[model samples]
Target: MQEISYKQKVLKEAKRQGIISCWFFLANFAASFLIAVYKAFTQPHTLKQLQNLELIDSVITNLTTLAATIYIWLAIKKLADIYDTDVYEIFIKAVIAVVLAIFLLLALGLEGITPGAVKAVSYVLVGIGIYFFILWFKLNFALAKITNNKLFKTYVFFAIISAVVGGAIKTLAMFGFFEGGVYMLAAALSIAILYVLPTAFYLYAWTMIKEE
Candidate 1:
């Protein structure tokens, strides 16, 4: 077999990441849109109907998330060679943890869930978020190590800014510091960050891709 150089490897990885990013955005977008339509149409006039609808939504969301995790994992296992990192294992573990956490989060959204369960599960979610932090760190570290590209760093901060500012606004609104419209805006902003901001940065990074 012909020995491939570093530039070839980087290019291959870049192309792979580009494909992965598109699928990530599309799959999540479809899931989000379907969820919106489901919530809009599934308004129940009776207790049993409400329970059934909620169950269906949970299954839909969980399956979509599971698919996303697996699809992203395919891209992830490719990256262990791009930057020579050991995060493939970490990535697998994080995905497992996050899938569980997401289920817990969805349960918390259920109508009659207890406050005690919510409180306890909220802390567990935060702990699970730490796994995400580790995953993010590994990705950025690998990117920085492989190329001189600083776009990942920018993506990182803007992503964080979106979450922090949005969360603060949402929290204040919840505390009665704002009205309905403001609260809605805050919620939208947070969701937008979680879903849209990364894709924006990801596409930009691809435009600026270089061998390094």
Candidate 2:
């Protein structure tokens, strides 16, 4: 009975995390769009206003990302405990590494270090992103197995597809295969699909867990 209760708690946490994650993506996208619009229409005399708009966009994205990260960490920790897995340990290490990497980049920027060091940080960030993808894939795979919900496994493929499609569209646009408006529409749709599909699968996985 205790195990069942704990599992239910984790499922609820996972569901809440999924919703927050979706909001993070959507809010960031909206913020970016607004910034772009502001830049396009703002007069040169409004330089301060443009700077403020960008600052607000940055703050919104950062706060939502932080909130999503916290919930994600909590859900992963609880799920790891229930499943007797150490994936959460990897997550903890990755979080630390990311913080250190960011700090190093900021310090280098302030010290006017060579661009090489900045490039190195960019590489580190890419590696950290891959670590996150691996962790996400493994966790969802485990959930798929335990809940017998194959929807959980589909998110990984959707994520890959979105990346590929988005890249292809951007490349084609660069070569004039698409008009500006067409490229923008395609980009927006791809991003929307990317965030929405994985979130839908995550929510469905939680529903399966609830049914179990």
Candidate 3:
């Protein structure tokens, strides 16, 4: 009975991850498409004009964080439950991570918000988000190492690439590397990276859990 119950939980988590993965992809695609369209219609969009529509960017961030968090947690749960490892602390971390990620996103969404100024406790939130982001990445990479699965490793490889390209483009854009039509290209690249990360992570996890 206990064994069967364990299997059921694993299966449940696997199915949940699958559903969430699809949603993440759709939400990401919609957000990116909307942003690109918005940029196209307003070629000469200024800081204010761009920032005004930042609300859309904020929504995208929220969706990204939410989907990413749940997807990570589902993976953690599957690994812990199946191997009878203690999942209590990791569950708590997952909650904290998800909340912080979403909160940072809300900061991004508001009309006046900027990376430099999130108003109150801004540094605190950003600090937490950065730490959690690194920690989460490490944990995931550790999982990939343990699984030694080709798919998981591939996901890891591409995730690194996505982060590099995304981060580089953002930095360049800050220095005006992306402007005019070039900015639109950057927008497309950003959306593509966003879509790919969760797709890779979720598919790898889903495959692992399903075969478990």
By TM-score, the best candidate is 2
Candidate 2 — which residues are off by over 4 angstroms?
37-45, 104-111, 115-126, 176-180, 193-204
The alpha-carbon lDDT assigned to residue 88 of candidate 1 equals 67
TM-score, cand. 2: 0.76
As for candidate 2, its clashing pairs are none
Q: Please, what are the lDDT tens digits per residue for candidate 1 over residues 1-212?
A: 23357646755675466556555565665566565556555554488866766676667666656665564566556556655566567767766787798699899989988889889999999988887887876676555555566876777777777778767766776788866556555655656666566666765765565643
lDDT of 2 by residue, 42-79 (tens): 55747788778878888988997787678768766766
TM-score of each predicted structure versus truth: 0.65, 0.76, 0.61
Ranking by TM-score: 2, 1, 3
Alpha carbon lDDT of each predicted model: 0.66, 0.69, 0.66
**Model 3, runs deviating above 4 Å:** 1-9, 12-19, 42-75, 86-88, 98-123, 145-150, 194-198, 208-212
Clashes of each: 0, 0, 0
> Of the candidates numbered 1 and 2, which has the greater TM-score value?
2
Residue-by-residue lDDT tens digits, candidate 3, 1-212: 99877776775675566557556766666776877687788689889878877877777867776786677567566766655444435456757776777677676678866556755556677677777766655555555554444555566567777878887877787788788779878867775675656565656565664444
Model 3 scores a C-alpha lDDT of: 0.66
Error of 1 at 187 (Å): 2.6
What TM-score quantifies how close candidate 1 is to the native fold?
0.65
